[model samples]
Target: MSALRTTGLRAATGVAASALALAAFAVAPASAADTTQASVQGQSQQTAAKTQQAKKQRVFKVRTEKQLRMAVRKANKTSGKDRIVLLRSIKFATGKNSKGGAGRGDLDVRGSLVVMGRGKSINAKGVDRVFDVRTGSRLVIKRLRLRNGAPAETESGGLIRSRGDVQVRKSSLLESTVTGAGASGGAVMNDGGMLRIVESRVRRNSSERAGGGIEASGGTTVIARSRLTGNTTGAVPGNGGALHLTGTGSVKVKGSLVANNTAGAEGGGLWNSATGDFTVERTTIRDNTAAGAEADQGGGGLYNDGGVLTVRASNIETNSATGAAGSGGGVLNNLGTLALSTTEVQGNSAPRAGGGIEANGGTTTVVASTIEGNSTGAAPGNGGGLHLTGAGKVTVDTTKVLANTAVEGGGLWNAAAGTMTITGSTISGNTASGAAADQGGGGVYSDGTTSITSTTIDANKATGAAGSGGGALNNLGSLAISGSAITNNAANRAGGGIEANVGSTKVMLTTLQGNNAGTAPGNGGGLHLTGAGKVEVGQSKVHDNTAVEGGGLWNSATGTMTVTDTHLRGNVATGAAADQGGGAIYDDGGALTVSGSTIENNKATGAAGSGGGVLSLGGTLELNGTNLNGNSAPRAGGAIEVNAGTADLADVNAVDNATGAAPGNGGALHITGAGTVTWANGRIAGNSATNEGGGLWNSATGTLTATGITFEANTAPEGPDAYNDGGVMTVNGAVILPGSGI
Candidate 1:
């Protein structure tokens, strides 16, 4: 060949290689794409010429084990793709064993060969492996069965061991095993080679190490339209009962089923090592188990260890991780990147955290997926649907996490070092039920930095006696939520919609409605803050919530709460004690500031209920540009109350408040028991009391100071506009209605 002609040919080959490299990612699994390309390109010229000369393919017929062995020996000397047709079943004896070469323990093929079994079988007779394909060779088996090979003390592969390219079509590999230390691949092992299993079945295979059915390393492995079932691995701290992959390779599984596989350690169905890439599409992995003896071994269906694993349009269900502290009943990703698209993960269980999935480190993305019906079946279990921890970053978009159960964080959990971003998702029908007082988060729990947007959280329950946060909880971290809905959730104690405990929480453009915290001493039917937890609410709605105290919101002793441009309406407080009612807001010894907000149509029922709209119980209450209207109470302080606390009102409106009981007092504003009320630029109008002090009432130990305040349309039998029972009431720039005076 001329030099110019050779250069042209090399250019053409480069173009073809580029095209093939691009096609590999789209057409095959990441692991199996380039497996045989290099071998095909590196073929010797003599081998190519011989392949051309044997284009018709020399055929050898074999009906017995001796004839088959003879044909293999003859074919090894030839340099072409020859065919050996099996006319009948052949059972190999234990005597035909060799460490190397064709005349020894295993049938070793050193040339390109094809075995056409024609639906026949090759039984190993409890001896060695069936075939050994050497390097730089190719072997293809079709319509055959390889069974009952017990390879003792071998490195891997009970049925076949290949160092070249091997393909099995429409075949079965059954009852094969590889035992002892460092052994793997009970059926097939490909070392630095390419393997393809198409339209096949691999069943009842066992391995002592990894890959009870198949193991591929340093190359590509592809499995399509096949089934792997009833396989087991006694991998003392091993992985992959069905398929194991490692060493910078890629494995693709499409249109297949992996079921009923059991692993002694991780990955009952499939395992991907740190340098490998694994992808599953249009497949099912079900009824797999990882029953390891150690605490950190899990991933009943699939495990990705520092690898890139992608699952699309697949189902992983009915898997169990039943070990001490074992997690990720369906999938476990340890320091790896995992992506799930349009997949379903359901009916999985774990003894500890992450009943469905656990992302311990690295990044995990779930898009258009469903995770449901999973549980953690032990005390102190958490994250029934998904758990993210240890600096892991997770993103959930347009996914659903539902019907999962745990002692804490029934739907999902994010630990202190994790970060989660959720958008356009739904978390519902989950339960957090435990006897511990502080264990509760029915929909989600985050002790990390979390952001939720355009999500829905409803119909979740915290059913324990002291449970809280039916919708979501943020403890010891920062949580920001916007454009979400939290409704129809119930908590046995407090925070039917959301709870912030020792954390920073912000809610914007959200709706919280129809939630109930109805148990006795229940607080904050819509939101609760305790123990120095700071909260901010803007442009949100809190409505139709029921609680014993703070029907809409409760701010505990040491927290700071700020509300702006929000609405609190249709809330109810059913407690009968004077210290237990705040229909819209209760500042229980906390600094609460409300600005540009609306508090309306809230009620405090029961005989002793007080403060239908706002209550300051030994706390600082500051209001600016806020409206409190149409609030009713049966006892005292129909709109605003101060109980040994300080209230500062600026540009506020209190209107149409009523005390319906016969001896009710202060229909709009009340101060009692060493309380002080300072009103600046506010209006109190259309308020009615059944007895005395229709608009303002001050007790003996209380002090009322007013500037630029107006009281209008107040009606009562005595002290209609202002009443001071041995209390100091200093008024400047105050206007009284035509019917009453102070």
Candidate 2:
């Protein structure tokens, strides 16, 4: 029995040993650039004669500085050989090439070599590069600390320079420096060669121009599970404090971090102009800065000027671009296709525009992302979160844009030539504060065709007196919204929810509620329209909005507006304007048509105010199968007031409306100035006036014509039903008057 137990225990021990061996060196695949870290393979099971793929893996162990020099010389002499140099717990302060010839610092390899350190370090105290790989050679570094290099030129790659393939794993490169015009890559430089870094760290590198940490050109670059920290470039005109990838090489970075990087010009974290695709996945780039402080310099986190750039599951936060006219603190994509998924861009600031992202002349798509807490460092800029310009198409899906502040388009400012769309997203808590008017769209400012589907725009603001405020959306182009909600938005001037200027807006199956246009006296609480624009709302709700005038909707356009099967209710209009106050809707120009809709529970709460439910100043207004009820006006027209305009009400109900104070008239309907009202097949009942004209009141020069109308149960002292004060009243069908009794 004892012998059998011993055999079982031995079998279990063998399985355990195998598991440990696999777990120790199970390295993930390397990504492209910026993410590579140094990783060490588990100590080789055998020392000198270990077999790999049935080949003799020549290995050399160096325990002293002299031995290291000899080994490098031999490897270079035997050019095309595969060799591994192991540092057997040794430390070296190396300098110059083996032949004391060309190249920088320590050692030069003309053949492929793997330099593995057994918990050792190498420093090139005042030299250029610690190691340089020749064109036909390759260098692999594992478990090493390589630091203290000061290169004379950027191409020297302060610590390591490679003209061939280079792989670094489980290593650290620190305190490298480069000081020269257009010089960069303090830690490492890959010159038209492939570079891979895994499980390593590159920190405290300084450069004069770009790529304080790493620079890759032409060849493929992959970085995985690494960190590039505290890298700085260019006290003058730097770019890419952490990484720079140019030429035709592909760059891929995964599971990495680039933080606390600083650039004097652009791209504080990374700059890629590869023309051969760039990708970053599961990475974080935070606390970076670009300090040009001049016009047209930006990209605090990343700058992609060429190639297709894709970022997945990344976080870019707390970055700043301080150029006088700089843009894109988080990412600046210039003439490149940018695709992002599951990314968060937050707390980034630019002096001018695009605090989170700026896409210039390219197509961009963001899916399941978040862009929030971004702001312009200076005033008078657009697109605090995102800026799309020069014919770029931007599509956002399942994204959230929140708490971004700018002078215009706090969440997003889109002037792209192609259409922009937001599907199943949330845009909220954004603000646009400017000294000028019409420079605000707290949530989004779109100057092109924009489609919003299944999105929510709420709690945004555009603050400025005389400012054109679209608390939720400002559309100067074509806008289409479906299955969306715009609510709890505020503006200090106008347009609490939306503002359309010289644009067309279509709202379908959307809800617009609890919006405020102005805290004081302003116009258009829920929406503001002007400048030859068209608006249409169908199967939607516009309710509980507060404004100084036109509480629910204000249209002063030369185009047309139509609302069908929508509800406009619970709105309040309180201000100083006598003829401009409208609790539910105010129309100054453009044709307006309302059918199968309801306007109710609206109030005009100021002295000399008019139109508790609706007010029309000019243009043709038509109402069909609509209901206007439970409205209160302090001045006149508890339900509707018209001035110098045309109105047609057919099959509509005006009931439960009242005048709030004395000297008020027209509890249900009032027409003044050059206005004309024609009613057909409608009921005006259960209305009360404080002074006179319980049902209908027409001032001199006004006209009221009614047909198939029923007016009853209206209470007033002077006129119980209808009063015409020197105005034209032509009744073609059964009209009930106070004294006429029928």
Candidate 3:
């Protein structure tokens, strides 16, 4: 009091003296002590003392609950260089009767707050959120346990709620529940901003509407190397129990594990609607299930509707959906583009169609993926491995379609008006059993136009009590096979290798061998052509196949067959007997033409039967430069037997063949109809019989010609018996032999 009073009095007196001096110097009148000047001098002195005190830098420690809150708030509003509020081992609690209540307490900070302790628990008695960030503020939550803050049933509580950008890295959000009617993001919610979570664990989080673990509406979200496990929604059953992204939001998940996430509807792992782009790379979607109490639910691992789904180097296994008609046990693509590369879709089963992958109205490109051991259980569905029903183009290249079972097209079934092109792939070991009388196509069944090139259709079996053909493939429409192999396939009734009936089917350079058309009463062991069916074989091999009549090929009454430069050898027709010949070839009631070909070493080993090498009944036999040799028959015509047909042989040879019973009764060539036999420039030599006419026996009122013909070394066992005539020439013909011998 003594020093302060003296300084005030001295300072006032000095100001008065200076004013009087200025009055005297300028010859002015004195003014009433200049009271405004004296008052300004006192204020200036007091402001100087306060500025000196503030520069001392005070250190305020926060130990009590109220002091900690005031320190955090003071640091938030300050704008200095190092505005930091330090809190060490402080115990804070919000009471139930407080102003903001226990549930409404938060440590709001706009600046830095260093909280250093391990056993510190800030209990907000019952609040909706522990930390809330306002707009245009950045929040970095690091190494903090942001758990349930309240026990109030009315308000849903979570760890962090932000309207701006929130980055939570190396943090754990545990045991938090959001329990409101339209509440989402039980643990963390990013309303309309970007959220990045890396190396974090989000577990035991619950939501009511959607996104039990984390939900992002219309922003970019990135989750990398995080574990989202055992998260759930409330009683209403939410979608994407781990992560639900909707409303045009894009999410890029890399190297994350989303396991044990359950939903009431679609997308047990991740659900995407509203045209969102979701990319999952090197991730695992496992042990997730969708109950599907809602309508039209799908995707046990991922449910994508009208979005782009790219699964690369990922494993989507052991996921299930229990809806009424759920599809795609691994993935369901309804109206989007699905591109899968180097992925495994295995051990999946569907109730409707496409056990591994189902595409209804989208374009699916599968490259270098394995679709194996999948099934559609007795649902009258198609394509156990993949089903394409709607009108879309599916291109499958270098994919393994193995061990898949279906009701139709065991490996692939394409119905409706869709187009499926399969090249350089194998469709093997697949099965299709029909319910009623017709189960067609064991490996692949197409009701549309299917063009198969350079593929193998092998080891497939179709078993129907009334099934017709094609153990490996069945086509009710147009089917073109070029440079493909259809071998080692068996059917129940007919067309053991391939059944092409009543359709515009063309097979070129396709080998049909080792095919059996069962033991039933149909034709065509290698191929069955009937009902205005046309088959043309050029430079193809149809050998070692078995059927009733046409062993190598079965042609019905209305079936037309043209074979050029083709070999039909070692085919058998063991119906009741071998009398129905054509071991090498059989021509039913149709027009047959053999030109520039050979039908040899075929046997009709039936008793008193004919037509061993070539059998032509009720059809025209035109042989031009054709050789029918080394064929044997117990009856007549070892090389050829023509009944009710015309035999036109030009430069043809029938040699080293045996036929008939006795002398003059059996010959190498026997013509028994009102047919004309013309041998222009060929040899019928070395043909033997027990009777006469070792070369030929024409007895059914037919005209024979032997111009430029030679018959030599033909032996009749009962020779010189007067009936044995013309070893050089025995003919009921206008015989004109240039050179001949006996």
Indicate which candidate wins on TM-score: 1
lDDT of 1 by residue, 381-408 (tens): 8889988868999998999999999888
By lDDT rank, best first, the candidates go 1, 2, 3
lDDT of 2: 0.79
Give the lDDT of residue 542 in candidate 3: 73
lDDT of 3 by residue, 1-742 (tens): 0011111122334767565333221111112223333344545766645444333222233334565555455445543211212233333356432334222265553543333223333434344455555455555545545566432343332666666667766667766767667677767777767778877778877777667788777677888888888777654646777777768878877788878776666676777665788888888877776656332455667777667777777777766655667666567666777787777777666666666676766777777777777666556656767777677667666777777766766677665567777766666676666533245566666666666767777766566654445444445566677777777776666676777665556677778787776665545677776566666666677767776655666655565666666665666544434336555555665666666766666555555556656666666666778776776666656677665556677888877777645222344666555546666777777777656446665543554555666777777654211122222223434442322222
TM-score of each: 0.91, 0.88, 0.66
Specify the highest-lDDT model's number: 1
Model 1 residue 329 CA deviation in Å: 0.3
List candidate 3 stretches off by more than 4 Å.
1-218, 226-247, 256-265, 271-274, 287-297, 464-472, 520-524, 529-539, 543-574, 577-742
lDDT of 3: 0.61
User: Considering TM-score, which of the candidate structures 1 and 3 is the better prediction for this target?
Assistant: 1
Q: Model 3: how far is 577 from its true place, Å?
A: 6.1
